[model samples]
Target: MKRKILLSALLLPAVMAFGQQYGGMWIPTELNEKEMKSLGMKISAKDIFNPDKASIKDAVVQFDGGCTAEVISPKGLLLTNHHCGYDNIQSHSTVENDLLTNGFWAKDMNGELPNPGVTVDFITDIKEVTAQILPGTENLTGAELTKKINENIEAYKKAQKTESYQTISVRSMYYGNKFYAYVIETFKDIRLVGAPPSAIGKYGSDTDNWVWPRHTGDFSMFRIYADKNNKPSEYSKDNIPYTPKHFLPISIKDKKEDDFTFVFGFPGRTTEYLPAIAVEKIMTETDPAMIAVRDVALKTLDEKMRVDPATKIKYASKYARVANYWKKWIGEVEGLKKSNAVEKKKQYEQTLISKNPAIKPTIDGLNQKYNEQAPYNLHKAYYSEVVRNSETLTLAGIYSNYIKAYEEGKMDAKNNEALKARLTEVYKDYDAELDAKVTAKILALYANKTPAQFLPKDFGMLKDANKNLGTIENMSKMSVITGRGNLNGIKTSDLNKLFENPKALVANLKKDPLVEMYGSFKSSYFETTDAKVTALQTDIDALQKKFMAQQMETDKDRKFFPDANSTLRVTYGQVKGSEPRDAVSYGYQTHLAGVMEKYVPGDYEFDVPKKLISLYNSKDYGVYKDKTGDVPVNFTATNHTTGGNSGSPALDAYGNLIGLNFDRQWEGTMSDINYDPKLCRNIMVDTKYILFVIDKYADSKWLLNEMKIVK
Candidate 1:
C-alpha cells in the first residue's frame, strides 16, 4: 500500500541523526552505556542508577516538590541552591533577626533549624510499565483512551507493595507512549543547616540571575533527619540526622573546558516536540501577554520592597520567585525568535510529512487544534495571572471555601479548628497595603485586556468605572475576605461569627460585592472556559500522542529521550562555554576576582559581607582554591537542564560532586524546547566555593570534617 511505503520513508530519516549532539534528558535505566561512554561519561550506567545497589541516584532528592538536593555527607547533610531553599530561609527570617540578610550557620547538629512542611523525596525504584499501562487501550481514542490509561495506572499503583513512608506514582513518558512508575520515600523532617547571607548566596540577585560568566555563590545547606530506625518521620526532638545509602564526595580538583560532566535531577516540564503552531503561539502571544502582567506585579513589588525593609523582608522570596520566571519568559521568547525555532519546527514537520503522507491528516488536526485554542489559552493565562497574583483575589478564593462549607452544612469544631490554623498561617505573612496596590493594578489590567465574555459578569459590568476597579478603600470595605481592610486585620471573632451561624454568613457573603464577584468568576471559569480548554487540550494530547508514537516507532535507533515531567533524568555533557551571539564569547568558569569586581558596598543585590570581602582580598581560599590560585565561584556546562534542576549536582567523570546546578545562560533558556548544543549551557555554583564559604567564611570546620572531601 502507498501508506506502507510512506511509513518506511518516514522511518528512514527518523533513525538518522540531526547532527546536534548530547543534549537530552535521558532516562537512567535505558541509557545507551556505550554511546554515553563515547560521549565522555567515565562511569557506568549502574553507577548512576541501580535500585538494588548503592549509586548516585540514592543521594539525589526532590526538594519540597520544586527543586533538587544532594546528600554530601554520610549524615545526610544536604546541599541545594540558596534560591531553592529561599522560602524556608525566608520563613525563619524576621526584620529584627533577619536570617536572610545576615545568614545562619549551625555550629553543630543541635543547632540545625527544623523547617515545618518541608520534605525531601528520594527515588527507590523506577520501572517501565508501558506494557501493562497501554494494553486494552491501543484501539481506543480521545477520553476513552485517557480513562483506560489512568485506570491502568491506578491499578498498577494499588498493586505495588509500598510502605506507609513510601509513595508511588506513575507518569507518562514520550507523550504517553510509555509509562514509568517511580517508588519514592519522602522524609518530612528536612532542616536548614546553613546558608550565606543573601548578599553572598544571591550576588547580583535578579540582575545576574540566568546569566553566564557569573559569580553567585547560590548554595545552601540542609540536613535530613529521621527516627532512630532511619525511616521517614516528622520533625521531633529525638530525631537524628539520617545516614544516606550513598552520598557524593565533594571534589577540590580544578575543572577545565571539555572536562566530562553530567547532571541528574527531576526537571519540571518541557515541550520540545510541540508542533510549529504551538511554538509560534508561545513566542508571539502567550509568553508576551503573561510577561506583561508579571512585569506590572514585579514593578509594584520592587518599588514597595525598596522603600520598606519590612516589606522587603516579607516579599523577598515572593518577589524573587515571580521575577525569576517573568524574566525567563522574556529570554525564552527572544531565544525562540533568534533561533528561528518556529520555522525550524515547520521545516521538520514538512520533511516528516513529505516522507509519510499518511500522517498528514493527523498533523493537520494538531495544527488546527492549536490555532483554535490559542485565544482561549491566552485568556486562561490572563485570568490566572490577575486573580492568583493578587492577594485580594486569592484571599477571596479562601472565603469561597467558607461559603462552600456553609452551603454543605459541614462547619464543625474540627473543621473550624483547621480553618483557624489556615487563616493564622495566611495572615502571618500577609501585607495589606502592598496586596491592595497589586490588586488594583492587576484588576485594571484584567478588566481592560481579558476578553469580555471570559471576564466574570460582575467585573465586566463594572468595566465602565473609569477602566479601573474602583478605589481600594471602596473595594476593601465591600469585601469580607479583606476584612474591611486586609487579611491581616481579619480576626478570629470574624470567622467565629461566620461559623456560629452558617445562614447569616451565607446571607452576608451573598450581599458582599467582592464575594459575589469571586463566585461569578469561579463559576464562569469552570463552567465555560475551563471546560472548553480541557476538551480542546484533550484533543491536542491525543493528536500529539499519535505523532509521538509514530516518531518512536520510526526512529527506533535515534536514541530518543522522554520529555521532562518532574521525574528523575540524567543529562551528560562537558564543561564548556559559548559565543551566544556574535562578539560575545563567554568562558567556562568565573572566580573570586569576578565576585569582587561585581561587589558594591551597601547595595542590596551586590553587597558582599565585609568578612567575605576581607577573605577574598587576602586570597584566603585555603584548600578550596583551584590550581589557578583563585577560588572558583561558578561555571557553565553543556548539560541540558531546566527549572527543577535547581540544586542538582554537577558531577565530574568519576562521579564526584564538582558543582551545584542553579541556572542556565539567559540566551539558552529556550533549550527546554529547542536545544542548541553550542548555546545551551547550565550554570552551577562551584562546590569549592561552597566549601570556602563553609570552612573559611562561616568557620564551620566541624561541618567540613563530616563531608567526604576529595582532592
Candidate 2:
C-alpha cells in the first residue's frame, strides 16, 4: 500500500499535465481556470463564456442543428465548413445554374438567397439544474426513476422564466450524475452569402478528408437575418441582417507551432468512459460490421458516380455523408488497436478497483452486461446500416410510418400533405436503378454477415445464395414500393395519383413486398433484440453511473471532464503537428503550393479551377499569404474534436478567430472513445485561406469590408 501510494504520488503530476495539455471537452461554465491559465490562455474563463454579459459564446451558434458556426462580423456574417453547408448548396444547385460547381457570391444583401427551414441556434444560457432535475429520484431505479426524472424536468422547465422566443432544454451529464438546462434562441432566416467552388472549398475531396497535411479550404459563408427588433423570425424579405452582441475579430497575425488555441462548439457525442469490454466490442465487432456494409454501398455508388455527371451531382452530398463515417470507422478501429486502448483501459480498471475494492463488482457487472449485449448490438448496427444505405428500403420505412398512422386512425389531412411533401424531397435526387443495385449488394453482404437468428425471414431465403442478384432483383420488382418494374421507381407524379385514394393507397402498401420486409425487420429487432438490449442497458447504465462516481472519488488527482452530449463545450490546445505513425511526421500546416502539387486538370477529386490556377501562377495571394511566402490552407492542432465540432471557431489566445475547425487527423478519429495526446489532432482551415479565397479568388472584397481584421 505504501509503495503504491508513493508511485501514484510520483505519477500524478505527469497525468495532470497531460490531461491539461491535450484531453477534455470542458464545460464553459465550469472551466478549470488555473489549468487553462497555466497552459498559456491570455483571457479569463468568463471572457469565453459569461451569462451576465455578451462574450465569445454569443458569437458561436449551432449551425443547422449539427455543425458549429461563428459570427465573424457585427452584421451577423457566419463562417462554417463547406461540407456542413453542403446540403443547402446542393439544394440550390441545378444543371443551368450550378452553384456547387461555380460557387456563389452575393454582391449585395438583395442577392443573398434565403433557406426556408435552416436555422442557427444561439445558446443564451446554460446553468446546472441537477438539484431541480434529480432531487425526487434518489431512491428509484430503472423505469420508475426515468419517469420521475421526466416529471421533475417538465416541472423545472415550466417554472423557468424565459422570453417567448427562447426555449428551454435539459440534458443529463456523466451518465445522469448531473444535469444542465440550456436556454436557446433560434434564428430561421439564414441566407447564403458566398462559397468557393468545390474545386477550392472541397479541394482534395474524400482522398484528403481525414488525413493531415490537408490543403482543403473547406469553408462557406452565410448571413443571419432577423426582424426589425433583431429577434428570431421566419424568412421574409422584410427582415434585415442581424446585429450581433459579440463577433470574433479575424486574426491575420502569423501563427506558429505552440500558439495557444481553443475550439468552442456543440460537440455531438463522445463515450470516453466506456469499459474495456465495450472498447473491444467496438474495435473487433460493431465497427467492422458497419464498415463492411457501407463498403459495398460506396463501391457501387462510386462506379455509378464516376461514369455519370448527373449522378455525381445528385449523389455528391449523400455520398459524402455515407463515406464520411465509413472511413472514420476504418480509422477508428485501426487507432484503437494501434493505441492499445483496450489494454490501457484494463490496466486503469485494475488500478481503480485496487483503490476501492468495493466498486469492483460495479465494474465487473458493467463488463458482463456488455458481453451479453454484444451480439444484439452488432445486429442493431447491421439493421440500421442496411436500412440507411438502401434508398428503396429507407423509402419503404417512410411508407411504413404512413401505414402506422393510417392504422392508428390519426392520418389527418395535415399528416397526409406532410407525407407527400417529404416523399417529394426524398425522390428528388434518388436514383431507383442505382438504389436497386446498391440494395442487392449490401443486402447480400448483410445476409452473409448477420447471424441466421437475427435476420428477417426474407433474408433467410437469400442466405444460401446471398450473392444471387437475380433473386434480389425479382424480390424488389415484386414490391409496388419500388414502382412495380418501373426503372425510375415512384415519381412525384405517381405520388399524386397514389394519394388520390388514401384508403386504396393504405391497402396497397400493406400488401407491398418491400414494406412487409421492412416491417418484419423492425418487428424482429424490437421483439427479439431491442427489449433484451434495453433491459440490460438499463442495468449497465445504473452500474456505470455508480462506477463513474466511484472512480471520481478514488482518483481525486485526475481531472474528470464530462463526455460530450451535443451541448456547448470548450476544448483547448496549441497549434502543433503530429507524427501519426513511425517516420511520418506531418507538418503543422499545408499551403497552396501543395494544392498545385496534388492538382490534376480533369480528375474529380484533384481538379483545380482555371481562375485559381491563374491566380496561383500570378502569385496574387494578397495579405492572406503567410510569412513563409505561400498562402496557408489547412493546419493541424492538438485540440480535441468530433462530428459536431465541424465549423467550430478555432480561437487564438486573445479570442480572435484564427481557423475553422473541420476534420480530425485520420489516426485521431478514435478520440471519440479514447484520446492519445500524442496522436490526436484536429484539422482546421486557416482563416488566412478563407480570406484569400473570398478576396483574391472570388473578387469579393466587399464581404471582407464587414469583418474586423486584427493584423
Candidate 3:
C-alpha cells in the first residue's frame, strides 16, 4: 500500500467527503479513522487504547524520561527509550565496568541484575462521571475536596465489584467535576533486556544532540517478569515472563509524507491551552534566557574539566544535566522561530474568538492571567533555580564555622552536634576529588570572566580573598579529611570531641575562606531560594487549584485530558515525516550503513569500540533498505513526541514497534507547541540495527527467539 494513497483515503472522510486533505495526526481530538484504517489499524480509539483492554494496563511501563512503556511478552520483557534508560546504562558503567564503552550482556539469564528504584505501573481505569461529582465542590477545603473525590471513587468501585475486571481503580478529573473507575492487572517482574554501545546508542552525544541529519541509535530494551499466576510480583529468580494480550505487530513498510500515525506513551507536559501572549513570551524571551544560563554554566564546567581530568569526573553528571536542558531549550526556540508557532497560535486564538462569542471572554480572562504571570516566573527562575547550586561552597563555609566554634568552646552542645551530623551525612555521598574539581571549575569562570553585575553587592568572592581566609584559612588549614567516609565509618564519639573545644572553633572560622564569603553570601541566598520559594509556592499552589478549576469548566462539553502533571498517558501518532520548519518537507529514510560515514573514530564522542567500528568500516550494512536507497544513517518522521517520549516506541502499522523515538531535529524542537512535519522530524534507531547489534555483537539469541523477527 502506497503511503500517499493511504493518506488520501484516510483523510477523505474527515473533510466531509470533499477534496481537501486533513493534515497529519495534529488534531488528537479529531483522529482520521478511515486513513488510520488504511494504514492497518483495525482498532478504534476505544479498542486500541481502551481502559477495558486488560492488556493496556499490563502493557504499560514507566521510563526515566517520565515516559511510559508496555509489556510485550510473558517472559519479563519491557520496552522503552534509549535515552530513558541512559542513566541506568551510565550508572552500570565505571572505569572497569565500561558498559558504555563495550556494551553490556548477561550472556545467560543468570547474569542479569535487577535495577533498583525503578518500577512499572498499569493504570486500571479512567472514566468520566461528571453527573455524580461536580455539584458541591465549591465550598470544600483542599483536603475535603480530595476526600470527596475519593469517596465518589469508592462508591463506584463498590458498585462495579461483581464484574470480571476485578482489579479496580478510580480517578477524579477536572478537580471534582468528573470521576471514573478502572480495573487493572499490574505486573512487577520487569528487567533490563538489551542496550547498544554508546558508539551506536548516543552516537553524536552533545554535538548532534538537537541537530537533525542525525545518526544516533537511541534505544534500549527490558522485559517484564511475573509470578507463576501471571500477576505482579517483586523480583525473584523464579518469576516467569508475562503474556501480553495484544502486542503491537511489526511491519517493514515505511511511512512517507502524510502518513497517518499516532504516538503512544505518556507525554510529560504540554501547555497548548495557554494564551497567545504567554506563547509569545516563551517564544521570544523565556526559553532563550534559560538556554543562555545553561550555556554559561556548561561552558564554565567544560573549561575546568578539560584542563583538569579530576574536575571532569566530578562535573560529569552536572554537565550532562545542563547540556540536556540547554539542548531542549535551544531546539524549542529555533523550532518556534522557523514554524512561527507563536504567530500560528495568535491566529488560532483570533479565529476561535471571532467565531465563538462566549468562548472569547473565557479566553480573554485566561489570556490576562497568562500575560501577567509569564514574566514574573522567568525573573524568579534566575535567582531561585541557581541559588542552591551556586551557593554550595558558601554553605560549606557555614558548616566549617560551626565545627570550629564547637572545638574551641565558642558554640553550644546542640549547635555543635547538629553541624557535625549535617556535614557527616553530606560527605558520605561526596567525592572529594570530584568536589574540588567542580568547585574550582565554577569559581575560576566566575572569577575570571563574569562581570560583577551577575553577583549581589556583598559577594566579596573567592577571587578577592586570593585563596587566603583570615580565621577561615586557619581552620581549613586544619583540614577535615581525616574524618571522611560514609555513615558507617564515622564514629558518633569522635563527633563529640569537636564540640568540647569552642575557642579553636572560633579561631577556625576566622581562617576558613569559604566561611568569610558566606558571611556576605548567606543573606542573599536566603532572600532568593528560601524566601522567594515560599512566595512562589503560594502562587504555584493557587495555580494548581485554579488549574483544577479550569478542568472542571471544560468537563461539561469536552473530555478533559489532564495537564500531563508529569503522569503517564499514552498518545498515538503514526510513523511519518513532516515539513514543519522549512520549504523541503521531512522524510523517513535512514540506514545503519550511514553510521560509518558520520563516524569520526577517536574524535572523543566518535571513539567507538573496536567491534562496531570494524563492522561499519567493513561495510557491514546488513540488509536495511529504502525505496530510493539502501538506508539513511538517520531519518526524520512526523510523529508527535516530546521530552518524556525519550524512550517511546516508533511502532509500524501492525503495531510492532519498528523504531524508538528519542529526539526531534533542532528546527522542530518546538513541536510541543505546533507540529510542522518538515522540521519536526523525530529521531529513531531502526529496530533492524538494534537486532543486528544483538545478534552479531552481543550474540544473545535467546532474546531473538522471544520476538517474531522477520528478514
Best by TM-score: 2
lDDT of 1 by residue, 257-295 (tens): 677888999888888888888889889888888887898
User: Model 1 clash pairs?
Assistant: none
List candidate 1 segments past 4 Å from native.
1-22, 32-35, 87-99, 113-118, 157-167, 186-191, 225-243, 300-318, 413-441, 451-473, 476-480, 483-506
Superposed by TM-score, candidate 3 places the C-alpha of residue 65 at a distance from the truth, in angstroms, of 8.8
Please say which candidate is ahead in TM-score: 1 or 3. 1
Tell me the tens digit of each residue's lDDT in model 2 across 1-711: 011111110121221224344478998998876776776789999999999999999999999989999999989999999999988887889999999899989898899889879999999889999999988798999889999999999999999898878999999999889899999999999999988899888887877778766789899999999999999999988999999999999998888767788999999899999889989999999999999999989999999998999999899878988998998999999899889999999998999888899888988798889999998998888888999999888889999999888889988889988988888877878887778788888877778888888887767666543455666567677766666544234434477777776777778778877788789878988877888888888888999899888888899878888999889999988777666666555667788888888888887778999998998999998898888788888888788899899999999989999999999988889999998877788999999999999999888889999999998
Q: What's the CA error at residue 397 for candidate 2, in Å? A: 2.7
TM-score (all chains, Cα) for each model = 0.87, 0.90, 0.73
Could you give candidate 3's per-residue lDDT for residues 429-519 as a string of tens digits?
4444333434443444334333353444534354443352342334333334323222234332365554355455455545445455545
Candidate 2: list runs displaced more than 4 Å: 1-22, 90-96, 226-240, 302-317, 425-437, 464-467, 484-493, 502-511
RMSD of each: 7.9, 6.5, 7.9
Clashing pairs in 2: none
Q: Which number leads on lDDT?
A: 2
Whole-model lDDT values for every prediction: 0.82, 0.86, 0.55
* Ranking of predictions according to TM-score: 2, 1, 3
Off by over 4 Å in 3: 1-43, 51-58, 87-96, 129-133, 139-185, 253-258, 305-317, 355-364, 367-375, 388-562, 566-587, 617-634
- Tell me the deviation in Å of residue 376 in model 2: 1.3
